[model samples]
Target: MTKPSIVFLHGSGTNADIFRLQTRKLAALLQPHFTLLYPDAPYPSGPGPGVLPFFEGCDPFATWMDDSSAAAEDAYWSLEDDDSGAARLLESVERLVREEGGGGELVGVVGFSMGAKVGMEVVRRLEGREDAGGGGVKVVVCVCGTVPYRGGGDVAREEGGRRMLGRGVVRVQSVHLMGETDPWRAEGEKLVGYFGEEGRKVMWFKGGHHMPAEDAVNKQVARIMLAACGKV
Candidate 1:
């Protein structure tokens, strides 16, 4: 049988190559069971956080959207519903799935940081348009993720105009890896909350805002991914 495909999306200001290096350990464990696909974002960007020194030579970075500091701050405060970039990303993933999946199933998505947000947004969009035969993503693995930019439309608010929690739950089995001391831990938690609790597994690592480097953690994460892929 043709192996299923899993799309791996890189964070903002990073390219597919850097994401491959970051998730090498986890990919090593999953490669036997799945075909992994990494695609670069459309917009050029400066180096993202944690890309200094070691990954300095790996320049020519990219981002899914206009991730300027000012724009990001404004979006966060205004709850802007701009999803054009995420839509373009979905187009890229669909093309990659058609070209690179080799007639195999498009199974899951593993994304990091901004990639995580973009990936989930794409998945959520697919969920709405999927047919009864079920071609939507089966699982999602988010590392240091953030909430989507209102792809499902403006989120419902409470009487006081406070955004309602669990209003736009993603109906997919998900694995979220959060860094214990990461600056964006809260955002990661919010991302987890967006997924259905029954199928969501949130794991925390000791490090901050990076992929899990420990052998044990990698193995554990791999096992969960295997289960998601129905390999174990």
Candidate 2:
């Protein structure tokens, strides 16, 4: 049987390199069962002095929008709705799936921090689009992130509520890995709870905003993601 493909979207301000370690291990362990693809984010590096090219930025290192600071909030909101860059990325995924002869394969997504946010957005977008292939992103593994605009006030709730409702009564399995003391924990749980009690998994670790680089945590995360995808 042909293996299902896994697409890795790096966090904001970071590139595909973030997934290199996880992908290598997962490919070895899940050999012949999964193929991995790590794509670069769409935005160009923002202007700044002393920037280490790709090595400088905030936590999870992301720039999902043109002007990171100016339109950060707006970018987050528009990410799932309809953005040219995001659309291009999704198109690339579709092409890859078809090219690999796995148009309806059991695909999974692993996203860290900002990438996790984007992954959730992608899932939300896929929920309604009939043209989307690859079996509806079977499982999603989100590390150190929460639903967009969940607690920003009434506007946030209304925006999130719409997407949640548009998800349309379908339960998608999700694994949320958060730091035990990570400030985002409460919000993360709220995001999970919004799923309405179906195939939602949560794990808390002793770390910060970034995913721990420990071998054990990486392995465990991969396992959780694969299991959610029905690969284990």
Candidate 3:
């Protein structure tokens, strides 16, 4: 049997480089049983000094999009092009899986921070049959991502709830790592609520926003993810 493929998506601001340590550790332990792919985010470093764009209106160390109107336009364009960085990420995963001969049965996605949001969109798109060949995502692992941005008000309600149905109810297991003191902890909890069971798990760390401070936390989270992938 082919090893399971685990795609790792970085959070905003930070690039795939940040995952080098975790990937290396996991690969050492899970190799011959799992394949790992770490893809960079879609935003470019801004002209300003010391800036990484990962999302609009939010910049946490690195970002996936900019908050400006022009940045929003760029983001929309990037998302539509499919050839944008995000598309390249999807393509890279597909290519790696094919090269490894892993087939589609063992494919899964793991997204951190902004990447988690991107992972959700990928699941939504794949579930919608938006891909060229009509493939579905087997499992999604969201580390610390927010609920996909719904418009607002009733529109947001309708979009968030109704849009998920299009994906046909695939297995979605969410792992929220949050610090009780972290400002985003509440938001992370809210995101977990959206999973509505189906193997949802939350792990809290004593520290602030950066909870996975030690190898123990990483290993624990990896174990949860592996189980979610049915690898354990």
Candidate 4:
């Protein structure tokens, strides 16, 4: 049988490599069932202080947006609903999918923090479109994520983002893993709610704003990934 492909998206001021490190064990667990692709964010480097807390020692990270300051309150999430940059980001994902997925389309996506916002936004963009069928992402996993806005038509990257009602309902099944002490816990809760009461799950683990490193936690996360790929 052909293996499925899943994209791993990283948080702000961090490249795809960081997420790989964070989920190394889980990736190993799911390797047999799915081909995991970690696409590096295209934008160059971002503000020094904007880096994710877990990546404090990492150098010269990349970000999905052009936020001048990485302040938790100031940093905005979501693909600008009507911006060309959003299209570029999607194109980048598709390009990498074409190259790494071996002519196969992405089956699902797992994102962290800012990347989670991207995962959720991509689902919104593809909703009701022709791409919603098979070979498209059917599941999304957001780890310690924030909410995205949709009402405003043309949004700038630098705009202050307020959590508004999402533009369209997300038809994909989703899993949200939030940290007990994570600062942006509410945002994750709200995002899961936006997905509606069905086809979604929300869980809180012991920790703060970072992927759970415990072996048991990783195993559970792997099961989620496997289930997403219809391997379970």
Using TM-score, give the best candidate's number. Answer: 1
For model 4 the local lDDT of residue 13 reads 71
Model 3 is weakest, by summed lDDT over 10 consecutive residues, at 46-55
Q: Best to worst by lDDT, what's the order?
A: 1, 4, 2, 3
- Across 1-232, the per-residue lDDT of candidate 2 in tens digits comes to 5667777776555666645653465445555567776766766554222224545443243345442343434544544456545565566666766776455463677776667766765665565563454246677777776555544566655665576556553356787878787666765666665443577778777776656556677677677667766777
Task: Find the candidate with the highest lDDT and give its number.
Answer: 1
Per-residue CA lDDT of candidate 4, range 115-230, in tens? 88777666666664545552367788889887654223325312334333434456688888999998888877766765655778787789888887778877877787677667
The backbone clash count of each candidate, in order, is 0, 6, 11, 0
Residues 1-232, model 3: lDDT tens digits: 5566667777656656655553465445555556776665556653222222322343323445543343333343244466654465556666766765456343567776556666765655555453467754556666556544422444544554465444354345666676666666665776665554767677776765542566676688767766656668
Ranked candidates (TM-score, high to low): 1, 4, 2, 3
Query: TM-score of every model?
Result: 0.85, 0.71, 0.66, 0.79
Task: Give lDDT per model, in order.
Answer: 0.78, 0.61, 0.57, 0.70
Task: State in Å the error of residue 230, model 2.
Answer: 4.0
Error in Å for residue 100 of model 4? 1.2
Regions of candidate 3 where Cα sits further than 4 Å from its true position = 22-28, 46-63, 67-92, 99-106, 129-138, 150-170, 214-216
